[model samples]
Target chain A: GESVGLHLPTLSVQEGDNSIINCAYSNSASDYFIWYKQESGKGPQFIIDIRSNMDKRQGQRVTVLLNKTVKHLSLQIAATQPGDSAVYFCAENRNNDMRFGAGTRLTVKP
Target chain B: GAGVSQTPSNKVTEKGKYVELRCDPISGHTALYWYRQSLGQGPEFLIYFQGTGAADDSGLPNDRFFAVRPEGSVSTLKIQRTERGDSAVYLCASSLNPGGHETQYFGPGTRLLVL
Candidate 1:
């Protein structure tokens, strides 16, 4: 079926280490992609976004990489901290409709 | 300015009952959307409101699920004859418009538990 999925369901990283979460999208028409972090009992908070025209976008401590040729997206968090522990989701947009992936649970162990 | 807000952070109802969840968008936001999040799953789009009208309701599960945005600022999601399967976290988000550049600010969400 057509959907977005992550390569890993959960990822654990040591404090101060770098963490990378991968996502695969099936829709070739997706023009934009965004990464969001959702703490327990809270809604998803926007992290960073990238468009198909660009291959990489960097935020404060996060970076989003898009490979339109492979239909893959990646989110990299540098110097992961305990406060960053949450479920991270990758969303893809085609036209104005957005679709989300199952999400990757990120746990930063201190 | 404050972000989006939702009423009744938690609600519990029995099966076959009716329930309504409300969402108040940020000031000036013209696009509102409703999504449902199941355990360990991503938020699934339920409906979208552009201004005061429903622009796309293709994500609605069935006739029992309905949503309306009367004045373009606040919206409500109504579930008729709710079933246990309807239990999930209902989330509301608002954006400047239904475009890619506008960030979608989300509310805390209303956790609905159907017994």
Candidate 2:
């Protein structure tokens, strides 16, 4: 079955440093990709998204890079803060059905 | 202005019991979605609704799981003969349109425990 997966399960970064999370997807037909952040006991919050046609999309302190040929996607957070500590997930949309990755826990140290 | 909202923030049920989870989508949004997230995992797509009808139900695990959106605003997910494996956080999201590229706003989610 086609799935989205993350390269690491946990990441720790110091405050004010940059953090990057990587994801690999197996479905080639997926056209849309999204990043979500889930805090403890809460649902996923939309971070950013990018389409297959675009290689990169930037948000406030957040950036999403997509590599269609490599079936890879990444989320970069600048000046990591303690509030940024949470589980991050990447999802791919195929035929309006979105498939999500297992998720990577990001821990920001003060 | 308001995002999606779910009812009964938490639910605990015994095996063989039936339960219903409710979701109130954002005002004027025409698309709704249901997902399940287990421990240490991302939300798994369960179903999607466009307006008053279900547009995609392929993610439903089995017949015991059912959902309905009668008024195109509030949707309900029903689980029958619940098992312990059914325990998870059920999330609801809504989007302005029914497409893969549209942004979907999510709710806090309903936590269910089958005991």
Candidate 3:
């Protein structure tokens, strides 16, 4: 019954601007969360991950924030570029299995 | 050799047909996973293999779906009596360890279309 979901189904942002995508998970026992980017016709690529023990984690130009109390997760991309345009997914790791969210389609327009 | 590779980048089969998808993980990786991705949706976990044995296959939808990793390396996912709903992209991933927390490297995935 564990499921990961997102707040926004799609998001459009201007190039060079910051973008924030949110996700919600249904499992409290999940110990780890990850973010992935999938371009069309390609598999999902690992972006960054955060442990339940940590509230925030940063990688490259992206930052993942976890709020355990509300079971909410967020991914922030600084100065987003056109190449950042893709479907971003949030995944929760529980019982050695990873469940992915419905994903948010991020469109960065020039 | 560097990343996971799936065979037959695309497959089209009719209903009630049997199809086998193959996945070759990165060398020396100890864990492999299979997932199904429907149109406009995120990937759904189908099964997980640790070494040569399947650690978890509870995610497999029904008896029509099965997979095997005999030598702890290459894997094959078999589906019997496939239906229209079986159409989806099958993804395979591998990690260095069998733990829940590890960076998974994914393949390009095989697109299956059941007509």
Comparing chain B with the reference, what is the TM-score for each candidate? 0.97, 0.98, 0.99
Clashing residue pairs in all predictions, respectively, total 0, 0, 0
TM-score for each model = 0.95, 0.95, 0.95
Error of 1 at A33 (Å): 0.4
Candidates sorted on lDDT, descending = 3, 2, 1
What tens digits encode model 2's per-residue C-alpha lDDT throughout B11-112? 999999999999999999999999998877788999999999999998899999999999899999999999999999999999999988988889999999
Candidates in order have lDDT scores of: 0.90, 0.92, 0.93
Worst 10 residues of 3 chain B by lDDT: B96-105
The reply for model 2, stretches above 4 Å from the true place, is A1-8
Clashing pairs in 1: none
lDDT of 3 by residue, A6-70 (tens): 34388899999999999999899999999999999999999999999999999899999999999
Off by over 4 Å in 1: A1-8
